[model samples]
Target: MVLTEYLSKEALEELVDSFSCAGAFELEILSPDGEVLARSPKVHSNKDSSINKEEDFIRFELPAEAEIFVGGEHVGTISLRGLWRTGQDSSSTSVGVKDSSNLALSAERQIAISPAAWVELMRDVVVRLCDLSKQVRSRVEELSAMDRMTNTFTEKKDLKEIYQLVAETMVKVTGTDACSIRVFNEERTELVIMAAYGLSAKYISKGPILLSESKIDREVVESRKCVYVADERTDERVLYKAQARREGLVSALCVPMIYRGQIEGVIHVYTRRPHQFDWFETSMIQGVASQAAWAIVNARLYHEALQAESIRRQLRLAGDVQRRMIPSQAPKIPGFEISTIYVPCFDLAGDFYDFIELPDGKIGICVADVVGKGVRASLLMSSTRSALRAHANYVRDLPALIKAVNFDLWRESEISDFVTLFYGVIDPTNKTLTYTNAGHEPALYIHEGKIRQLDVGGGVIGISEDAEFSQETITLSSNDVLIIFTDGLPEAINFEDEAFGRERVYAAALEAWGRGDSADGIGKHLLWEMRRFAGLQSRGDDLTLITIKLQ
Candidate 1:
């Protein structure tokens, strides 16, 4: 049988090309029967060396490299000869056998060996070529499997289905009796079986595989490579010897599925009898492990995206509900202009503001900020809003009202959780304001060119049930403006990480008041100045502002 039948045209040509010396005649590898199998490129500058017929090229015996065998007979020794016009030296005779396929005696100089020595030399080259062929075929098989696995993952098959496919395919590829696909549980403390093939249900139900219990898996995970056990009976790493025996497992190979330097999972292959894995099986299984890791990562990302979408929907619903807690527009109190804006950095915000209509032409204005952010903080803000609203009309005194709200919040909130609140009742008929600030940003009161921070309340609400609160009463004056805001406004960061602090807040509000802007106009001007100072910087918290002017 010809070697070409066993090796592809490309493979045979590759064997010849490797032997093509620079500035030399192209080499032709021929079968033992003198049939041409492969020819290297015309490595020589001249194309004149192309042979017109197979007989025209002289062939030399390579002797058996013992590479190919059929039916107990050593077969197909490789041979090489130059692709040149058959010739003999007219001026000087060569010592080799006279064949019409030979070039002139000058070509014989390139060989520089006897017929026997040349055969020995060709034998060595043939051995190396066969070894290289085996390696190339192994890599090709591995790459083909990898491509199939990648496509399987890209198709977005169900993650469980992919796990089963990988388990079955790995067992088939490695010719193992059983294979199991396992991934770390959420806590990373246990390896849960995702898929198993060729294993009995009784054996698989052997209990949890903890990372702490198995030295074998720990080594695989820590080493980030394949671990092989020759005998399950004697191996100390085999934590389940009895189970392995029941399952008819002898030798096992375990490989870690690693992606981005993190080991995601493990794939185990077991043979019923002791069997050592070759390079081909080991490399192929490692490739399978890597592909498995990729599938795992993709599956996790997909699930996380689904979870994020669900949370977003719930947040929108919650935000809508909490937004209702904010008055649709600032309360239109007689003898006063009220303007308010609530800006949230995220979909859900911790900041909230409300205008409660109290008895007898009195309007209750409150702005509060929960201690944290996001859904948790937003929920707390909602709770605080309910508690404050519940007591706002019932408790007539400003200090008593704040104390009641604080006690309620303290009863319901965690030790670290609290709300900073500013609540006030403005009686326009009497031109009097009764207010309390509970560890909140002080209300900026501008009365006839005099600036005062209404900072009288108490420690923040929800920390202590017995927290004391103090009330401050002031008589309203014409053209006086009051600004109440959450800490986000003054603590707003700029690109340089500097804060647009209380000074800036005071300046902006003072400038707008000086310009004789209406309450709504002043709120807009303050927001514009805040945005200007915090140019292109991302806010980490929510901003809530309320502007009140005695018109």
Candidate 2:
């Protein structure tokens, strides 16, 4: 503490007054430069007399003076003087001598206390007051330091910045020579230094420290306690005693940084002198460590939440784009009704469908399912759809269109990814459907209460560039329905692990047809039946279905 902070002029005057009353004499408080800061009243009527000149008081000056101290540094002195009277009172009647041999003499003096005793007494009182002031100053300093440290922890947002601030604040508050913050790795096998203050880079980068190898760090972390080591040069618990000695560190304290009852790291403070850590200092450092831990945990959690939100936004965008890729409504075909349904288990789908109008009143209908899910599958599906559309504009043959699309997918997509597709063209003039099935579930044809499977085509797309395909034409009479879908329909599982198999699909189609359901009605009924079978189970894959019913 600074001397002037607690030893103001008014305080000095009060001290001098109290001392004068005790010593029964006037006293003056002088600075180290001999300037008077405070003075007590004198017994004699000499108030107007100046005490600035040391010459006037030299005759009555005390031989002893008491020194005022602040934190062991002397700032000023206190002194006392004797006041004397040298004549008789005017009220006394004096008799004169009769002759030259006779004479009358009178003298009066105010008794003063012994200078040595007064000096000792005043010195003790001043020393005690100074000591009390020092204690008060130290307490105020500590409280202010803690307030700053707590604010630092609360205001900082980044974990690394908080760590550095904590280390620096710890060093400042405790008057430590250096400080280091070591946080445990995710595996909890080692302690990694996150921040350091007032330490040499060479000493900080000494080497890796494994928790198993460092007993002191391990004890502090596992036991969630603070550990202190005095005389690091001789303490066996010191992990880097050689480095500590080189860094001129003789004392150390390690406090655990814990959050939610789990220790996350340790805050290590080092001092240059071999000093023991008191209870107050240890408790204060521990409190700082606790706040640091809370800040670190909050920072980590906030970062994770931000990352999760970013992923969610990306998924939503992908879902929107994938949905837009699929046709929003089916096209109009004379004497025919078309209905489509798509259900993706995730944000992006592997299943897609397109209805392209061809030349001469013919319409191209395609349903394809990629082998996988997510963004990759969606990309492959998009590329395949573009290829099919481009090829269908020129290529009239269903088998040739399938072959072109297969070649493009095989050349452009990853070798592991493949697509199963059913491409069919309906010739309204001839009332015939020509199609090719590329390793997909066969389209079911229901006519006159009889169900038939249209299973013709080749291997799945993207498996081989040289894959061959075939096309077949089937006559469609009135009341005939064609059902095309991905394997997700038949492979959908129930709570009992029972699949809604080919037989069930055929039965559902037959029942819907018998009930005189339209294309949309039949598709909706099939979905309802599938959901009923699945019961609380999630769809294992992307689901797509298209139904074409002849009017």
Candidate 3:
């Protein structure tokens, strides 16, 4: 039978060197397993060193410090003082031995020795190895459970699911029989319990804890680390602790969970026994808490991204609908030249322009800008245009037609939201232009190479429900042009932040008309001038330009 004491290689080397210098006897050192590890001589006396053979007569075993041994051509001394074991045992004479597998080492050796020392050494070695093995196994199992919990959270995409996962992991990893997770609300300066296990849900539902008041919980948050207490009964920090008493917590561990460098939450693990946790245990739990924090952040980001994409898609749809509402082609009025350009500041334009050739050979021209942008503005613009077109067939008088349009818009739209319009009818046979403006920008008229402006209109329509509108008339001659436009053109800014005001717009029109005798030539030149003036500057509003000439 053989007995052995397992020492780390470094400890063994020191002991072997000390014994060799003394030259007491030839020595054979074996592993925790019965296999000989090293020997004073280069080769074995009778047995092959490569294999553990039953035919070998000599077997070496670990001996206690100060112990002596001698044999035929083989002898040794061992020191157990520096050796590490699960625990200490003084009386035992038996030695512990490990097999080649390195899994288990046994001290129950059938060796010849004094009964008291033999029995004691065997008992101590066996018990220590067993306990150490169990501890290692438990640690591995705990780590495996932690991995499973983190994986479960990572598998989920929704933020709501993370609460349940974190709570379960905390309770399981701590072995505390109960656990809870909470978040801090900086705006309200309160802690909101998000999830809990092994506790009454009804009691915790009434949450929102003020950190400034909660001594234990707030301390954990402020410290930004794990807080632990071995015994709440004697701990000075745990005070006014009615909840801790009710929860039957004799020991507690509170760890702060951080996400993206922010203190997002805290996890509480409670135990009934007075427990002093080691650094390894606290660090392991903190690692798990960090995983929970990351999971929560990822879930929230995914949710927000989905919401933003949904909003963008809705805006795109609204833009498509608004575009379909506008006329695709301008009305063709014989003996009159008409051209228009409409540009929106946003994806969906509130500005709209249309030319309707009436059955009476008169052309109705409209350029309107709804007061806002997006779906609401587009809807209002669509409604206003529809109402005007329906009423245009009934009223030939420009003032009456505008008054009727205003009544319809004010009745249909909210008081705060309104439309600014410039509407008119062109009788080509008489070359007469009559227009009614609704608080819109002054219309420009370029005649005989001279620029004339008209701003004869009342307040904005649909603003004050009882707003009045008036009309003005002027005659256009052959080769004379009438320019109806939204404020987008005149109010456009340059890089210097200066507005391309009415003065500049009027000058551009005169210059444009003087450059070309035909209305088509003038329209092209005006647009070119505007584009150049507004270079690199975003269009501040919806721009609608309509030019009509009686030729």
What are the per-model numbers of colliding residue pairs?
A: 0, 0, 10
Off by over 4 Å in 3: 1-155, 173-176, 183-194, 197-200, 203-266, 272-291, 356-361, 386-416, 517-521
Q: Candidate 2's residue-wise lDDT over 183-267, tens digit each?
A: 8899999889999999999999999879999989988977789999988777898878898889898989999999999888988
Local error of candidate 2 at residue 457 (angstroms): 4.9
Query: Could you give me the TM-score of model 1 versus the true structure?
Result: 0.77
> 1 or 3: which has the higher lDDT?
1
Q: Candidate 2, 354: how far from true, in Å?
A: 2.5
Compared to the true structure, candidate 3 yields what TM-score? 0.68
Residue by residue across 210-264, what tens digits does model 3's lDDT show? 7777677778877888998776556777653565666566787888889877888
User: Between the candidate structures 1 and 2, which one is better when assessed by lDDT?
Assistant: 2
Candidate 1 lDDT tens digits, 1-551: 55654577787677666554421334556666656677665433344454333444443333212234433434355433433333432332222333422344345334444433443465466655555765676568767767887888877647788888889878866668899988999899999999999999988888889999989999998888899999887788998998888788899999999999988888999999989998878988888888888887888788789989999998888888777777888766778998888898777888988888876768888899999888789888988888888988788988888888888888888999999999988988898889999999988999877679999989899999899999999998999999999999999999999999988888888898899999999999989998999998998889999989998
TM-score of 2: 0.65
Please give the ranking of all candidate structures by TM-score, highest first, separated by commas.
1, 3, 2
Candidate-wise lDDT, in order: 0.78, 0.81, 0.68
In model 3, where is the ten-residue run with the lowest total lDDT? 97-106
